[model samples]
Target: MSRHLIYLSILTSLTACAGNSRPAVQQDTTSAITGTDTLNRMVLVPGGTFSMGADDSTGMPDEYPKHSVKVDSFWMDEHEVTNREFAAFVAATGYVTTAEKPISKEELMATLPPGSAEPDSSMLAAGALVFTPPNHAVPFNDVSQWWSFIAGASWQHPEGPGSDIKGRENHPVTQVSWHDAQTYAKWAGKRLPTEAEWEYAARGGLSNQIYPWGSEALTAGKPKANTWNGNFPYKNTHTDGFENTAPVKSYNPNGYQLYDMSGNVWEWVSDLYDARYYAQVENGAANPSGPAKGYDPEDPALEKHVIRGGSYMCSDEYCRGYRVSARMKTTPESGLANLGFRCVRSVTHH
Candidate 1:
């Protein structure tokens, strides 16, 4: 059988085991205090300043003109929000994520090229990206290479209608857009962290480190963060103990007690994306929000929003986006298997 089929079988077996158990399974509350819970529940990240952006060596043009940013203290979740926590929110609020809704025929047609096939009826109706290994090489910039507009893919049915969050309760919740994240944040009496705030917290009090763990490569002579460790789009040795998303807080916390700030999943930030936003800030302390209006030439549809802290899919050969300074622009309406979020509050109040 193919690796994908085998993976699906394993997941299916695990799901069955999960579903047979009681809904009120006790989580490791003790670990939660130690900043090691899998629920994406994190200890507060006491925020402070460090250089934001990058020095000349980091190739990305957008990370150019390295600058300083001072961020006030804040209380941040130790990890990205997880399926179990998001399930509670949905159970309480009856919240329906945008990914759960079908794309209208009109909207689908508007987004697709003139000759593209109609949305696949056999696939999950509304789901997020699920990092299935591709049979061939594909472009990273063109999301169509790996992302399938699966139906029935939402916080509940993460892989699609046939899939459920049973065994994956501790996994980070995917298929969540920025709007969905905001809604959950409000419901939880929190809000999305501003990009500055997010970066500062992600730094975990480390100074000028490439990742939350510092300048070491993810492998770093020993198994480190959860990330791809093999050739892209074909094999995943599972060297990091996961081929896709792992349970939240599965790894070590950064210096500031924040978990998964560098990997596992990419997180949403409040700021709108502007490649030049760093340049505009230029070592100043204005605490700037992105442009008042949203459209940018790089992404005309304005669908893209700021996403930081790359996902399990990140690899040195392909996307080194897991770095602390790394930033990616994603569609606000777009949800992917590797995309999830955490909440934050101002230290003074929360």
Candidate 2:
């Protein structure tokens, strides 16, 4: 679909939904080949060795200790899992996302304080975190100021119960938990890309470059990808012509013919996130699949998976996650407005 047409459709849907309701990876080496028609618009990424971490000073601690790693050949979706694509998956399989399933008492208790009483069922309603920007500038340290878990906020109803994905069929599906992504991947006969494979494809054969595109400049000339321009959580210049998610393939593709490798939304990988996993990796590892388990010193209680690329919410003043080497972590069951994913198929060796 054309970008202008998709944008128009989305605007129309947003109005109707509001009026109607109310509210609201991995592998490989030699004999590598690039071929199409293997998957739904798949792009062949002939994997090779590249520096896995960022040496830039802006990199986070977890993205440090740059090392060399190799990946085998694989076919990856050129664009993110769009709302249209996910709809097809659900239509065929009757899948229910984690955001649509009620949170269990056991799950709530796991994260709560000791002896914390389980509240009424009302508190366990199915929901997801929706980004609600504060009216005024607030400290970035407290994320609660802008994020709220709104009931009925799933991929279908992005804003809440009153909202719908009417016009956003082409936009990347958000509010999808990592488990939900895995489920869709399974149904589609594909799997989530490992962190190594993801970075390799995202780099687009550019060794150690800061972004999928050749330039390190976030906004040197025209906006290359969708990202926050003004101060984060306070203002958005919409320099990329999008304040939120854009239609898939709205921008240019990377060297590997993959789109949205940098922004629009954070793409989930199969790897379990561990901040110090890089230090433990054997040098010159081939097709590393990441740590067997997840760990994050910042928040030890939650099990997290690695999310690559960044989202429209990423900003230079705040997140800088849009950088190719930047890394972020979130629990498997937690879904936010800016979290989505793509799928990959491993090349079979004869």
Best by TM-score: 2
Clashing pairs in 2: 23-162, 24-162, 24-163, 25-192, 25-193, 25-194, 27-72, 28-72
Off by over 4 Å in 2: 1-40, 110-114
Task: Estimate the TM-score of every prediction.
Answer: 0.81, 0.87
Cα error, residue 132 of model 1, in Å, equals 3.2
The list of candidate 1 runs beyond 4 A from truth reads 1-42, 106-125, 138-143
- Give Cα distance to truth, residue 141, candidate 1, Å: 5.5
Question: Per-residue lDDT of 89-139 in model 2, one digit per residue for the tens?
Answer: 788779999888876667666655698786677667888778888768887
Cα displacement (Å) at residue 51, model 1 = 1.1
- Candidate 2, 290: how far from true, in Å? 0.7
Per-residue lDDT of 38 in model 1: 41
How does model 2 fare in lDDT?
0.77
Please count the clashing residue pairs in each candidate, in the order shown. Answer: 9, 8
What TM-score does candidate 2 get on C-alpha atoms?
Answer: 0.87
